[model samples]
Target chain A: MARHIYSCPLRWSDMDAFGHVNNVVFLRYLEEARIDFMFRLAPGDGSPSFSGGSVVARHEIDYVRPLVHRHAPVTVESWVTKIGAASLTIAYEIKDPDQVYVRASTVVVPYNLAEERPRRISAEEKLFLQEFLAEEPAAV
Target chain B: MARHIYSCPLRWSDMDAFGHVNNVVFLRYLEEARIDFMFRLAPGDGSPSFSGGSVVARHEIDYVRPLVHRHAPVTVESWVTKIGAASLTIAYEIKDPDQVYVRASTVVVPYNLAEERPRRISAEEKLFLQEFLAEEPAAV
Candidate 1:
């Protein structure tokens, strides 16, 4: 299971009144990481092709600790937790260099553009995601 | 109980590759509405003065529909849902002028800045919130 590490710089506007990165801002960071991971595996252009698109079904987030404003960049680690016939579960860990900040999991379903409904996962996508899942129970 | 309607312009960057406001972006919009609601009720100068503060505990969101890109403004309708001993639940409806976009609910826990933990709701604050919750739910 190889992990995909996506890094992003925190913008000034991302901070809230408490001087910590706003909780909602983490969702944007996570989306960027997920998009990057998908492009890495499939190697698509910037636009998301809809021939077979993906949509989020649900998201479960646990903010273990608040991320404070920092000079250094933050890393978002993501991987497929479970791949089903028509859906997949992706998990994320957001952290600075030393400490883990937030953890989240999202359920994504593959949609067939033609049918306008969810479709089964392709063998190719399953193979690609296989490289990222852990052998035992996945963490973070 | 009068409903406070807060309108926010959607930035071009708020849209994702799907040509709609990203799922995560909705959370930020909700936060803005929540903050604005708090400020309107309490009428405080913008500062980190949390001698009496609040934090979000749990959020249950429903993506009933999607809001597409448009030049028109998006309206966020927010109101108190329920007031508890130490927590307050707020409901939000994000919509365009004529149609519903999304529905969301959040639980916010009041905190004492001095104690640095959750605290019981004050009589004055509870009365204010009760008035807001007494109104009918938003259309969106």
Candidate 2:
């Protein structure tokens, strides 16, 4: 089971009045990690890389701990938790060296942009996702 | 039974390679709407306004339609759905007069940041939240 980890830089604007990183910013960190993973599997030249357009069907995030503002980058670790014929579930964790801040998952569906509908994931793409499939379900 | 609706401004940075606002940015929109509602209830001078601290326990978003980059602002309509002694649920809809782009909900808990634990919501705060309680659950 392969897992991808990306270092996500934090911005001053990402902090909320609580002096901790805003909950919304965690999603951006996960997005950066997910995109990095996707591009590695299906490299593109500044164009639509996935077999078809991909849209996030749903996102669920559970905040475990409050992350404070820091100059150091936080790590976003992501792996495919499940893969269906037309959709895939990606699980993510935003963490630092010591503690995990959030656990999240996003359901992404292959979409046909021109037709504006859901589409099937290509066999090659499925194989790509399988390469990083988690051995077991993500505990979140 | 008052509902708050805010027109959120979009920035180019919010757009992703998908030629539309990234799913993550929708969370930011919801945050802005939530903060506006909070400020209206408890006014503070650029400091912590909530009694102690309110942390997002969880966030769930369902993307109804992909929002493309537009010059105009998108309206985020929000109202409280349920309130407990320690937590409350907020429901939101992102739209632009014609179509709804997303439906989302977040569970927020009154937290004791210094103590690093959840705290009970105060009576005064609960009273403030009740002012904008929704009559029924969100249809989406």
Leading candidate by TM-score: 2
In candidate 1, which residue pairs clash? none
State the lDDT of candidate 2 residue by residue for B52-96, as single tens digits. 467888999999888878788999999988989889999989998
DockQ of 2: 0.81
- For each candidate, the DockQ is 0.28, 0.81
Error of 1 at B33 (Å): 1.7
Clashes of each: 0, 0
Q: Across residues B2-112, which tens digit of lDDT does each residue of candidate 1 receive? A: 676888778888888777788888888888888778755553324432234666665655565667778877899988878888888888888877777777777777666
lDDT of 2: 0.82
Candidate 2 Cα outliers beyond 4 Å, as residue runs: A43-52, A112-117, A135-140, B42-52, B112-117, B135-140
Real A-B contacts recovered, model 1:
0.15
Q: Give the runs in model 1 whose Cα sits over 4 Å from its true position.
A: A1-3, A42-53, A96-99, A111-119, A130-140, B1-4, B42-53, B57-60, B96-99, B111-119, B132-140
Best by lDDT: 2
